[model samples]
Target: GESVGLHLPTLSVQEGDNSIINCAYSNSASDYFIWYKQESGKGPQFIIDIRSNMDKRQGQRVTVLLNKTVKHLSLQIAATQPGDSAVYFCAENMRGAGSYQLTFGKGTKLSVIP
Candidate 1:
């Protein structure tokens, strides 16, 4: 069995500060990794993706770093904002024999103290 958990249920930060969201993944054999941002009542939006072959990837205002040795992952946001307050989840894609499925972490809630 595999699972993901957040170290904290909620994080409060100032509007101009940077934010780091952490996730713990259970399955090390997973090939693809994705970070998603979910706004209230909305579907998760793709933030960035990285393959097992790569250690890090970056996108507009966001960066994702993966550490395979420790089975850990993290998301970095450049500037915190009120709009950036939301729940973020990490998903791992398990690929085998042409089959794939995404397993999502529980998620961490970000709260901006604007």
Candidate 2:
């Protein structure tokens, strides 16, 4: 398990193939998790999300898995597309004192080759 706050900054996948992106979080107290995709010069867009209580969650063509044991998180794309090329980020929603804040990882750039 690794963090967007750590590890390599890029990942490359072939178009039409499945892609698996990984993220490692630092806060064990984090209860909520989200995946964001950011294209060049654009804001990060929500891709998917999972709660600490859930081990897995699925979306249209994406899936998110959480391993609380090792504090690891991953995103699985069913069909990697050129449009999917972007910087992927993992963020955590931490709560304390009756309030919550967001913490984001570095980001992994996904390059889709046709």
Candidate 3:
């Protein structure tokens, strides 16, 4: 149930503004979270990550906030740009039964209008 599919394929944004992308995760036991950015027709690249033990994690131009109590996560982009336009995916990793696997939430499309 953690698998994600976008309702829209594209999002247009102005070049110099902040962007917030949303994703919904299914597993309540997931302990690790990661955010990835994927450009048009490209593989997803790691943006940032947060563990269940922490509530927030930040990167150079990005920040990931996790609310384990509600099973919610969010990614914030400082400045929007044409190069920043891409699809964003949130993934969760659950550790149990002596094994771990990543479950990806449906992605949101981000488009920056330059």
Clashing pairs in 2: 2-24, 4-106, 5-106
Q: Which stretches of candidate 2 lie over 4 Å from their true place?
A: 1-8
* Model 1 regions lying over 4 Å from their true place: 1-8
List TM-score per model, in order: 0.89, 0.90, 0.87
By lDDT: ranked, best first: 2, 1, 3
Candidate 2 lDDT score at position 28 = 93
In the range 1-114, model 3's lDDT, one tens digit per residue, is: 122344755567799989888666788888899998877667889999999899888898888888877789988898887888777889999777998888886688887888
Model 1 local distance difference test score: 0.86
Compose the digit string of candidate 2's lDDT tens values, residues 1-114: 223333547788889999999999998999999999987767889999999999999999999999999999999998898999888989998887888788998888888999
lDDT of each: 0.86, 0.89, 0.82
lDDT, residue 85, model 1: 84
Overlapping backbone residue pairs in candidate 3 total 3
Report the candidate with higher lDDT, 2 versus 3: 2
lDDT computed for candidate 3 = 0.82
| lDDT of model 2 at position 30 | 93
